[model samples]
Target: LALRSLAFQMSPQELDLGPEKVPGPVWGALFETHDAGAPFSLLVLHDGTAHLYLSTGGGLIGSHGLSEVSQASQRFMTQANRLHHQARPSQDHPLPAAGMSSFYFLTYQGVLCYTAPEARLGDGHDQLSPLFHLARGVVAALESAHHHQSRHTPPAR
Candidate 1:
């Protein structure tokens, strides 16, 4: 749904998410889509050091450093069945000693966003508030778009 909304409302331009220095045994993934005239991309990259970044072709927009935001985000995304994980070197850790996991969201205007929690396990939630709020707003926007679309579409024959 989020992807659909972005694809339908974003500009049709080339997105440049900048460069990444991913470490060995780790992989990065990028997802791109277009719909309703909107085009967007999501890039999840990790250096396999201690950082994971999310971007929309405009460089690093958000990141996670294995902190509380990471935990919370993981929990929420997992529950929502939107979290995608790669091979973990260990099962007990949220992230491997190297490598980073990717997450995605969007803005009200349909611009796509990527957020990866940083600051570590003990870090406060100040930075996370924006992410949470943005996600909430995006959800609302998606729902609203869905409702509007449903109302205008003709019934099946």
Candidate 2:
């Protein structure tokens, strides 16, 4: 499935179907970053399963499963829940322009979304800065874990 289509197609229940399961109401989030190269999307479930998709393939490219949710990821979810009121209910999941990022929250109610420039988010000038940074931190943790795993895995013949 196309990463952008996820906002319109994926449901919270579908996102909850992973190896790990969070015992509570199913919820999920999607973060899309548009840059000079292929757009990137990070889809995170309450279960701490994250799938990273690239526009080049229009499908899932990588997935990282967390044995336990990191503090930043948990905080990100909490902040997202609290800020849902600020996001407008969206049926159109528009792709942000280059250097911009779009965030989507999938709850029981429906899909909510907002977009902001990466610069503003990084500089803490955007209202969604807190959630943005927390998501970034989660991404960093995933990258670090992937790096560590690669180093330990034996090379294939």
lDDT (C-alpha, whole model) for all candidates: 0.31, 0.69
lDDT of 2 by residue, 52-128 (tens): 66676644334445543345466667777677666778887776678898888876767888888899998999889
- How close is every model to the real structure, measured as TM-score? 0.27, 0.79
**Segments of candidate 1 deviating more than 4 angstroms:** 1-125
> What is the per-residue lDDT of model 1 for residues 18-135, given as tens digits with 9 covering 90 to 100?
2232122123323333223333333332321112122232322233452433444333332222322221122121211222222332212222223343332114453344333333
The TM-score, computed over Cα atoms with residue i paired to residue i, of candidate 1 is: 0.27
**Maximum-TM-score candidate:** 2
